[model samples]
Each structure stands twice: as C-alpha cells, then as structure tokens.
Target: MRRSPFTTLGGSGFDGSQDAEARLRWFEHVMRRDMDAPVRRLSRMVSGEVEDVIACDVVNPDHIDVEFDSIGGLESIKQALYELVILPMRRPELFSHGKLLGPQKGVLLYGPPGTGKTMLAKAIAKESGAVFINVRISNLMSKWFGDAQKLVAAVFSLAHKLQPAIIFIDEVDSFLGQRKTSDHEALTNMKTEFMALWDGFTTDQNARVMVLAATNRPSELDEAILRRLPQAFEIGFPDRKERAEILKVILSGEKVEDNIDYDRIASLCDGYTGSDLFELCKKAAYFPIRDLLNDEKSGKPSKEPRPLSESDLEKVIATSKKTQVAANEYNSLRSQLVGLSRQTETDDYPVQAAISELSKLVVSQILNLQAENQDS
Candidate 1:
C-alpha cells in the first residue's frame, strides 16, 4: 500500500491531494445547493407572514378593558360578544366553580375582505383585557413536516403561560382548511396540530386563552373545526351606513369640499365594502394633497384646497359601487335600466313641484319616466 503525502502547495498549482479536496468541496457545495432547493422554495412561500401587533395585547391589558371608540361599525357582533362572551369572562368564578362551560376558547371572525375583521379582532382583544398574540399562518408553516404544528403548540403554550390572552390568526383558512384527506399531508398535519393545540388550550382551568381565527373564507374551513369553535363572529361587508362612517373616520383630518355631501356619497357608495371605502378615502385625500402641491409650485392657494368636490367623490363612488354591488343586485338593476332613454322635458310635468324626491332615480329610470310622459 502506498502512503499518500499530506503536503502544502509551494505555488498556486494543485497537487493530486489538493485537486481531490477541491473536487470534494465542489461536490459538497453542489449537494448542499441541491438539498437546499426545497428549503429555499419553502422559505419563499413562508416569507413575510408575521402580522404587526396592534395596541391590544397583554402588555396593555387595560386597553382591552377600556372601550375602543374608534371602531364605529360591527355593533351587532360587538353586542353579541359583550352579552354572550365578555360578560361571562368578567365573572370567572361563576364558571371557575363550573356554572357555565367556562369562557369560550375560540371566536372565529369570517367575512369579506376590507370589512375590518382584523380591526374587530383587535377591538375584541382590547375589550377582553387579554394578551394578544397575532399570528399569520405563513409565519408558522415550514418545509419540515410537523414544524408548523410545533410553532402552533409553542404559541398556545406561551399564550397559556400568559393567561387571559387572545391568539388572533389572520387569513387562517390558508392552513386550517377543510380536510381533503388525500395528498395534502402537510395541510392535514397542520389541521391536526391546530386542533390539538386548541384542545390543550381550552382543557385547562387556568388557560384563560382565547383563540381567534379570521378569514374571508368561512365556508372553506373544516366543518369539524367550525363545530368546535364556540362562536363565529360574522363580519359581513360594511353596509352603506358603515361605509360612510368608515369614510368619515378616515377623512376626518382632511380638508373636504363644502359641496361634498356625505349623505349623497354614502348613497352612491351603497354597495362599496369597507376596504373599497378605505381606498376611496385614500384617493380622495391623496388627490387633493397632490393637486395642492402642484398648485403651490405655481404660486396658487392650492385651488382652495380642492375640498373633495362632489363630482370627484361621485365618480369614485360610482366606480366602486359598480364593483362592490352584489352580482344579483347588479343583474337586477341592469335589467331595469336597459334600453332606457330619458327626455327631461319639465313641461311634461304640467307644473313643476319644488323638487321631485324621486329624481334621485338613475338617469336611465328618469328617461324612461319622461318618455312615458311624452307618449301620454
């Protein structure tokens, strides 16, 4: 057997040993790169999944107890929560002695996007005087099977340690899905782990922890999980009134036009969701500011601050209503408006009243009514 020399290179040239080592290093690097492919893919999928903490956590327990004056909508859900869930928690001894089934371990918030589901969850946390653990499903999910479950368990365990806490999971349907029972081993495992975590949380007398899962997709959740959840907070899209309130809340600080009528805007935005309302307000605020900035450069008084003109708002509201209206509503309205031609012949009225209350009808409807008068 020949003994190999362990020698250092006198120059940059590679000896057999050096070449072999280099090749080995390259092979190792290649293996590492190949093995890392799946991990990289998973990391990409899991990236940017943590939710920002709101002002309602264990650190600020009093915040939840104090009334949140900002959430103008969700009155029904809030009342239901206050009557059924919150009041019970206030009198724990009534349940600690096993009077009631203990406070609900979970509250699910389900609704369309932009209806302030997350905000409602925050308000609940603030009201409940509990520690708030805001979790994003992406933050827990991992390439390694069971890793997601472990994170979930850890969250519950920590929440339990800090009792009277609420775990708010946003977009929870991404993971806590309806069990398909085939091919999706990862999803199944996650659901099982979540359920186990939930059981552990509720089983304890000291576990004053409340689990809150929010999703736009309520129907997509597992029926079993839904069954277990004590209460489901139905966070529907903001109605016209709620949307108007949200708009007011957002636009409170901005300079609005005197001609801009909030009632009219609300009427026009009847079908707009809260999110759509938020965007509309943002645009309303931004356009004025941008226009003002341009006007300033030209030595003008920002065109009287362009107070959210009625036309500007109406156009925005009309665009939003077109999209926000339910398909059924849009179809129904479209049928009535089709082939409608208007002749706003005031003479047809014989004598004009101060104003026609029903002039608020769509132009198409007005034209149809006017045409009827002409024929008569």
Candidate 2:
C-alpha cells in the first residue's frame, strides 16, 4: 500500500525518521530565496500541524537596555510596573514557593497618543531582564484561515521555550477589538486562539511570560481581553509640574541660553505630551542651526553656533499646536467604564481604578442612579 505525501512527513513535508541535522540541511537547500519559509515550516510542525503565522520578532534581553530611571515623569506608573513585572521575573523563586504573590499575567498601558506607552514597555523589558517579543497587528494578520491562530500558539510556545520573556503588543486595540457576532470567521478564530494562549501563560506558574500591551483607545478593546489584562494604567496628560519636569529633562543635554525659562516654556506647552515636548525641543534646536545655514548660504555665517534661546522656543511654540483631542467624547466612554466596573465582581481592581479616574462626574451620576433604583 502506498502512503500519502502528507503521511510520510509526520503531517509535515519532511519524514519524522529524518534526524534533526538532516532536516535542517534539507530545509536550507529549498529555502535559499526565502529565509522564513523553513522557520514557518518548523513552526507548523511544532504547533502540531497547525498553520504557521509567526511574523513577530524576538529581541534578546541585551538589546533592551532602557532602565526605568531614564523615563522622566510617570514615577507612579514605573513603580507599578516594577512591582508587577520586573520584580516577579527577577525573583521567580519568591513567586513560585506556594505563595499567592504570583506575578501579574498581563499589563496594559493606555492613554492619548504620545504618552510614552511604548517607552514604558521597553523600560519594563530592560528592567525584567527577560527576552522581549515585539508583536504588531500586521504581524498577526494573515490571508490564510487558521494561520493566525497557529501563529498565536507558536508565539506562546516560543515564549515558553525562552522562559521569563516579555511579549509587547503595540496598538493592541487593532488586533483585539471588541468581539462581535458579525465578525469574520478568521478574525474570530484568531481572537479565540490569542486569548487561549494568553490564558495558558496565566495558568503555567513556571512559564514566566508577561504580555504588555499599549493602546490609545482602550475602550475599543473586547471585554474578554480586558479581563485578561487585569493590571491597567492610564498614561494621561502630564500636569503643569510634570510638563516643567519634562521640559527640563528634554533640555538637559541640549545647548541652551542661560536666560531660557523652563517654567514659561512648560506653561506654553499646556496640552503637550512627552512626545510633543520632545518635538518642541527638536524644533527649537533646529532654529539656530537653520539660521546659521541660511547665513552661510548668503556668505554671512557667524563665528560659532549660537545657543538655543527663549526667542527660538517661543517662535516654535507660537507656530506649533498641541495634539489633544476633544475631551467630552472620552469623558462619556469613561463613565460607561465606571458603571461596568461597579457590576464586575471579579478581581480586576487595577482596570476599574484606572477607568474611574477618567472622570469623577460620571462616577457620581452612576452612583446616584444605582441608589435611586434601589430605593424605588
């Protein structure tokens, strides 16, 4: 009796009896043009004949050299991540010794654009001393059905192999949107598979892989995904003091005139985020260089590079606008979240607290309605 081609390769294209070294040789021969084909093939085999969708890149611990102290402001956010992620990874023996003080399974950083969400993840990865896996939504999407699901499984398996790893999913809202009945079959399957893999990370005590995600629109995330990420922190706009601190930090290494006023510049950047502040500094730095270049072109270059002055910053500030969106829309969404939190009985306190801080007015309204309903 003749065996099918699929049966000969142990459900893969290669035969199981072949040695690992021999399999590698054959893979290398056929995949000269495409480097990822062999890896994908191997992933399919490791995933038990599941489709291959592994597009994410794994970053070694040495590459992530950013420390928590380097990130200015948001000290509270840094402290929480240290306790939740870095502490657990560094001292797993403390977590696994029958104590309920296990590390958090997943953490979410959410807020408006340019609030340093990705920066926080990098800092955590550096602090944790664990392998970092950076995954984007584009890496998860696939034209093939069931491919994304298998890829999700493969990613978790890779994380497990490299135990004590951090998987940072940037722009998580796009990949794990609110599940709907009318969703595409492939999308639904991918979501289900991703969540299942996430659950596995939580249950496996020895598997020290933490999922850290950042999103500008946390409200767009699915309820199921929110439950998975029990620890959530909002990276909102920096207060006036924080803005001044941020400006000082940004200008620390730059050549600035003695008369430049940080407090005044901070006041000018009313609604600016950490990123916006950085941009403002860059714009100010270029002004002097730009003037020098123009002078040189006209055969009137100065003796030396002039230091950035308050006039230059003021010019930039006059032309530059803050990127803050209208707050009323987010205020209403925040109220809805607080109301949902009240009904939730699970141990998702961090998520609830972050949502509650969005707006106190919404919280009061919801509480009054609940009280009136009970009285009636």
Candidate 3:
C-alpha cells in the first residue's frame, strides 16, 4: 500500500529528516510557481485598474493643478521634465523624425532626504496630466522570495495598458541596488527579471510609460539600472532663495508680522531640505498660535486673536533655523556625489559637471548669504 500524505508529513513516521526534505521541496516549488508568477497581472483584466489606487498616499491625483504651489528651487528639473518629457508626450508629431518621445528615457531623481523629490514628481504628473502610479516595493514584496519582481513586471505591463503613465518608484535603490546573488539570492534574480521586463517595455509603442525613480543613496544603485534611466536629476536641498520661497508657500495666509524680515529668515535656513523648511515653518506658525491661546484668560483679551509680533516671529525663525541640520550635512553629501558623478557618461557632462560644481560652491556661500540676511 502507498503511504498517505499524513504519514509523509508526520514527524514521528519520517524521523524529521524526511519531513524536512519534503517541506523544503514544497517551499521551493511554491516559491518558483506562485511567487515567480505575475501577481500584478492576475488582478487587472482586459481593461485596467485605477491608477490612484497605487499612487503614493501623500500625493493626491485630484490636486494635479498648479495652484501657485509650485515646487521650490529645482527650476532646471522642472524645465527638463517639461521640455524633454511633457512636450514630447503631448505632441509626438513634432519629433516624428523617429527621435522617440519621453516614454523611452526613464527619469532618476536623487538627493538628500526632505528635498522635494516626491513633490517634484507629483508636480510633473499634475503638469502633464499623466496617470501617476507610485510603485511601493513593500506593498508588492511578498513574504515568499522572488514575488516582488513578478509584481514589478506586472506594474510595467499595467503601465503599458495605461498609456502616458508615470511610474514613480521612490527610494528605488532598495530593489535596483547592487545585486547580492550569493546564498539568499532569490530576490536578486527576481529584480534582474523585473529589469529585463522594464527594458522590454521600451519597444511597446502603445505603452507610453514614463518611469521616475528617486533615491537618496544613488551610489548604492547598480550601474545597469542607472544606465537604463538616461534622464537623471538631482533634487538637492533648497538654497537661500528657494528656502525663502518655500517659507512663503508654507507660511501663506499666516499672521506673519509686516516688519518680519523674510530675507533674513530664508538666509538663516541654510542647508535646510525642502521638508526641513516646511517643518521649520510649521514650528514657527505653531508657537504663536499656542501663545495666543494660552495668554487668553476668563476675561476676553484686548485682541480677540492676538496679532503676531515681529519679535515673536523673529524668535520663531531663530529657533527653527537651529533645528535644520541640512546646512551642516550638505558639504559631505556634495563631496560623495562629485566623486560618483564622474561615471555619468553623456555629452552634457561638461555642462552638468559645471552646474554641480557651482551648486557645491553655493552650499558654502550660504553662511555669507545668511550673514547678509542678518545685516539686512
């Protein structure tokens, strides 16, 4: 008589070794068959699913309008995204000499934390009216090995179906980083397979998929993945002028004193990332409100809502500036990028290098800028 599955899986009957062997084999099969299959494709039908369902939570599809809320300080990136990708995408007929529209050259956005990389992406999608799919690795990354790559492939397949789609993969270095194909190598192979699929999508004429990846740790990404993305932009921290603009946006409609020196406030926030600026501004706004409320007693105060004083605002700006660590850390990041940026092979190398060098100089000049801000 043949042994039943009960006996095969039973620890007592198999002496543990046999059961272990069976379990390992079963795991291998499950991982190979199910995990390696297209998880993304199984859900979507002949039509397509909703794009916003996968978009980043912070980025809303409805707010895809320029409400004077433009991204601060990265004019060049904005222009490039518009000129190279947006215009071409909108009017493919102009570039009919077979030069190919944006869907071909994927974009890479790299910079320090809180530097508006994600914001910039949303702005692009808004400006272009493109379907934005925010690819989250953690969401697709299954407990079973090699599942994530299948999901990635499915995402591209979906992107093809949804033409003029912007696939924004944030912190992309995690999946496309240097492959570790040694012992725990399943994920590496999966990523490679996904990459191949991404490459294959280049040919699908109907697939107007524009890939945008962002990472703070650009050095960690594999060269193969980097090369695939020809249009790369660095989303560095806001400079003095940008910090001021960012503050203006964040502090909008707030009761800032008329005499409150915004130029000084912007100058002092040297090295602050875009997120940092927001944080600083938020902090500045919060304290005054708190004070106004706390000062109120049983009797109504002289002012129903206390008008924020210049001194109050100055104090807030000073405290907020102290909180920003980006100014101090910018130089180190700049050094590391300059070293790696040399590998970026393109005809615009000289221009890019010059711009990068100038940006680095600006970082140091921030203190002087800050000083002038103080004197003003």
Candidate 4:
C-alpha cells in the first residue's frame, strides 16, 4: 500500500497527535496564502519604489502655477472653496494637534465639462502651497488579479509620506463608479482599498492629505465614495455678467480693437462655457490673420494686420455656435446632486444651502439661454 505523507517522528504509525499537527500546519499554510500574501504585497508596494511611483503621479506645485484670481467666473464657488480648503491650509496650526476643528479630508467638484474643474483644483493646491498629485485611474489598472488594489494602497501610502499633498482625480466617476455585481473583481477591490485608505485620513488629525475629485457625472459615483467627500461644489456655466468678466480676462492680454463690444459678445454667448468663450475669441481673432494671409497671396501684402473688429466677431458669431448642454441632462444632473447633497449631509460640510442655491441658479441660467437659442 502507498503510505501517506503524514508520519509521526516519534513512532512508526500516524496517530491523533500527528493528525492534529498536520491539520494545524495545513491551516497556517492556507492562511498565509490567502491572507498574509495580500498583506505582504501591500507592504512591499507601500514601502518599495514609492518615490518612483509618486514622481510619475504627483504634480509639483511649481508645475501648477495657476493662481485663484486667474480663473475667471465662479466667484461664489471660489469663496466656498476659501472657507472649505484654503482657510484651513492657511492656518494649519489651528487645525493640527488634536484640535476640535479639522480640515476637510476630501472635496468633490462637479459640473458640466469645460467649466475649469481641473484649473480650480490646481488653483487650490497653488493657493495652499500643497503638493498636487494627479492620479490617473487608467495608470492604476493592472492585468494581474490583485495588482490594482495594491497600487491604490500604495498611492495613499505615498501621499502619507508626502504630507500636505492634494490628490486630484479628474473625471472621478470612471474611477469610482457605482458598485455592482457585474463589475470586474479587480476594479471593485481597487475601489474598496482606496476607500479604506481614505477612511484612515480621519484618524490622523494632521495628515495634510486632501482628496479632490472632479466629475461631470456625479450620479455615477459610488455612494461610499461620496460619503467620504464631505465638501462638494458645483461649477456652473457663467452668467451673462460673469461671461463679460471672462471676456475681458481673455482679451486683456491681446491687442484688440478699442470698441470690441465685449458685453454684446458675452450676451451672444449666453450658453458658452469659459472654454467655449476662449475658442470663440481665438476664431474671431483668426479672421484678421486670414485676411492678411489672403492679401499676401494676392501679392498685395499689408505689413500690419488690423485690430480685431466687431464685424469680425459678429461674423464669427453668425457662424459660431454655443456648446449648449442638454436641458433634460443638465436638469437631471442637478436633481441628482440635490438628492445626494441631502442624503450625504453632515456637520462638517453643510452643503444643502449651497446645493439649493446652485440648483436654482443653474436652472434659471440654462433655461434663459435655451429660450434665447430657441427664439433666435
């Protein structure tokens, strides 16, 4: 007969004591493989090659030199950010060392695309003098089974080491989507690990690590993730007055005609986002250059190009279009945010009033713009 591997060292036969030892050994082996292996992987990831990982992901403050004033429009959002992020960072002594008042651990910036979400995040880091880590979700994805989770853990660990860091995840919905059974196991595990690390931020009163995320589709994010981000703000389309300010800011550096009719341009671009406005200005300015190039091609080149004219802008406006956000889609996003604001209410971030005011403003502005477009 073939003998089993389990054999008593003290005697010839395998007995109950030997069987118990063998069972204990097998249990330890399983635990190490299933439990301890993950811990070791996490440890190694956190401790080893951290600098290299951070170098790839972390954006230095010098690289993000945009000041708060540089971002035109959204004055109320800026003030809210001052109270939520900048104030605490400015007076870190008051927030550190087990004080009752603590800085917000995370903030979420959500709104329509091209409204300067990334710029706003950079401005906060610039204002606070914090290291900004731009975390790309695609970079964290791994082909191996559990490597992505390990990478997520490693990111938090690196942030802890580099204190006073702002980890900005632009378009965060793709990274922390609503959890479901059909979701890939790797992605789900990565999100869980990221959340666990985020929860730890509360335990450290002076960690100086804030998570800032921006997304156009806030409803697609996981509820657990939203709960962690206590501070939230909506960066909506600039109103007509704000649009004029943005126009002046964009044209401030350019040599343009004295009578450019900025207010008229702003009114005409009622639905345009800040980015749309910039592109419009560029195209309008190009009309003068195009004229100069045509003159040169006809062998009647003028040495000096004419200043940008109202007629040039008007011509562009005639053909140019505003990036109108869909009425139902904008309303749906606003409603979702209003509901989420109510559901995730906490003392640290009382965003209900802000959300209510923003919702009303967004609805009014978008409706007015839509009415204008329809009338025209």
Least accurate 10 contiguous residues by lDDT in model 1: 47-56
Q: Per-residue lDDT for 297 in model 1? A: 96
1-376, model 2: which lDDT tens digit per residue? 4222111133334554555666555545434533342233333344333222232265545555467766778988788778878888999887886547877888999999898888888888878877677775566677877678767887788777655778788999988999889999988998999898889777877668888899999999999999999999999999888888888877877788988788887888888899888988887898888888888999994767789999988887776656663244445666677677788776687866765675566655765575466435
lDDT of 2 at 16: 45
- Residue-level lDDT of model 1, residues 1-376, one tens digit each, is 3111111122212333444446344334433544332222222221111110111112334333234456656777789887656655556666676736577878888887767788777776667666567665655667876777676666666565555667777887776768775737776777788788788767776457787888888888888778777698777767767766776776666777655567667777765666677777765656666778998998976456667766666655543433344445545654444322233455554333322323325644654564466435
Quote the lDDT for 276 in model 1: 75
Give the deviation of candidate 3 from the true structure as CA RMSD: 14.7
Residue pairs of candidate 2 with colliding backbone atoms: 9-14
Q: After superposition, how far is residue 201 of candidate 4 from its true place, in Å?
A: 2.0
TM-score of 4: 0.72
> What lDDT tens digits, residue by residue, belong to model 3 across residues 1-376?
4221111123112332343355444434433454312212322324222221221111223345442256656666677788877766666666445535425558898988788888888777766656566776665656777666656666776666545667788898887888764624667766778778878887655456778899999999889988888888888777788887877676667766667666687787677777776766665566666766777754547444455554654565564544245455575667666766666675596778686887688666765576567545
**lDDT of residue 6 for candidate 3:** 16
Root-mean-square deviation (CA) per prediction: 18.0, 14.4, 14.7, 17.8
Which of 1 and 3 is the better model by lDDT?
A: 3
After superposition of all CA atoms, the RMSD between model 4 and the true structure is: 17.8
Shift in Å, residue 260, candidate 3: 3.6
CA lDDT for candidate 2: 0.73
- Separately for all candidates shown, the number of backbone clashes (residues 3 or more apart, or on different chains) is 4, 1, 1, 0
Q: What local lDDT score does residue 305 receive in model 2, on the 0 to 100 scale?
A: 72
Compare the candidates by lDDT and give the number of the best one: 4
TM-score of candidate 2 against the unseen true structure: 0.71
Model 3 alpha-carbon drift over 4 Å, by segment: 1-60, 63-68, 100-104, 144-146, 302-304, 307-310, 321-376
